[model samples]
Target: MADITVKVLEPAVSYDLLTLDELKTILGISTTDTSEDALLEMWIDQYSDVIATMCNRVFAREKVQETWRGDLPPQDCARVFLTHYPVVDADIESVTCNGATITDYEIENRSGKLTLFGSWSEPIVVVYSGGYLLPDEAPAALKTATGILVTGARSEMSRSTISGIKSISHRESRVQFFDESGGSSSGAGAIAAAGDTVNALLYKYMRFYV
Candidate 1:
């Protein structure tokens, strides 16, 4: 295994996994209610980013260039995993190593794994377009999870003033809030300690990577 860095060449036009209308429907807010549109939009963006972070993958399709650095083990030559999954074979523009294009490679469309044939060099770079189309094309469960997350955040905000709350906790359930320094009091722990339903919806999509 090696260190992988992904750089977006053309960022997705929108990172929204759930649309404004969809969110409004979840919240039971009328489509004509313009009073809270700004606030709602902010929450939508924040929560969408949070969901992606939690899943360790973006749901919006974008062009990207990924680079691999450091030494790779012998077994790694046969298979290298890409950061983003569900890659379409046609979306892979190129895979290069040592400044030359690699033609003897097979792409695992859904898993984002690349099987390289014969000898391979270090510092492999892969250029590809992956991820869901988003909002409209996002998985149904992901959209449901987004709605749950936003609704939970809204409910928490309505309960008390933000300045007075350090973290969210109820009974045995707890979710730590990051301080001004962007570090949580819990040190290394889950960013979201959502309810059982929310957790269940997100469990399958969760990715644990180095």
Candidate 2:
């Protein structure tokens, strides 16, 4: 699988152009030409302070989750089970490929690059949406997420608030968020007779959205 890297850059052909404020917000920056390492160090230092404000401010909205904790409408069995909490900068992080398999590698600094990493053991299905890579690791606090959803119009900018299993990219479209978990029996989407199982998951999403 191609190493999928989601970057929020300027519009390619001129469809979506980010506003100044939106770009600033996404940058989480205040206009500076500081060294990348210096910026990263500052961000790492402020990670917690920013994340606290975000969990309450940015993501503050109606939310709910229906996993094994809730009842399944069709079979009444556990709809989805969380194998484990996705870890960041750790042994078991999600690859850009929507982790259906697992492996180990030493975490090294490809620091010469801008990145955010995430990994999930089980693939989660979203309704009117799709699966997401848990945004466990971020460059800064404002970039982190709580895996919750926000109702109403969600613009491209207001992303940390719009939630699911967590994703690194806020500007997610078909091209951006490719369901690489295709043809798998389990993980994110499971096979079911008459598609009831998928429908059931969708139903969970509807409830969350509504």
Candidate 3:
């Protein structure tokens, strides 16, 4: 038998595997839609219950495809079920955008219920200005860009932020996250472009609570 190639499904990286057109086809939607993000939204709108049933969690891309429903192809059906993931806001004690908009990112799963395994030992905040990044990647960027160089394990100061989060205030939105407390009242801080620029450099904040 000839060996077949199997592409990996890294739901964390949206570019892999399926496109919006693939998802649309699975949901029986028009491919003409300009925005792929919008098409995913449509899937949630029409099949909320079905999607919920598939929210089950798995460790690997192959595992995600393994949970596909009977009606659709493994990739297409799993992609539909794989479109969104729920954030257990309970784990999120307090969030500071640092001027970045707080938006929900959904990951679709076609399995059963999902339990996001992690330790709620402490509350953590992450900052991102460039292209979207994984949770682990965001914290590193936030630390370096905030003039707070930290590495290895938790440091003396980094350990403290977990306790006095709101106490550490921002003067103005440095990283385009106007919704963040650090933004300037004159409102230049509120500008996404300005904030993102400030966010790219350490001139933005004293430290981010990543």
Please list the residue runs of candidate 1 whose C-alpha ends up more than 4 Å from where it truly belongs after superposition. 71-77, 161-193
- TM-score per model over all chains: 0.77, 0.16, 0.16
* Best model per TM-score: 1
Model 2, which residues run further than 4 Å from truth?
Answer: 1-53, 56-68, 81-210
lDDT scores of the candidates, listed in order = 0.79, 0.26, 0.28
Best by lDDT: 1
State the lDDT at 40 in candidate 1.
Answer: 86
Per-residue lDDT of 87-203 in model 3, one digit per residue for the tens? 232322222222332233222222212222222111112221121232222233332322121111123333445534444436863332123333546533222323454335423
Q: How accurate is candidate 2 locally (lDDT)?
A: 0.26
lDDT of 3 at 123: 15
Question: Model 1: per-residue lDDT, tens digit, 1-210?
Answer: 478888999888888888999999999999898888888889889988988887888778889999887755564465677776779889999988878889898998877888888777777899999878877888888889888888877765664455466778899999876444235564321224455676788888777754
- What overall lDDT, based on C-alpha atoms, would model 3 receive against the true structure? 0.28
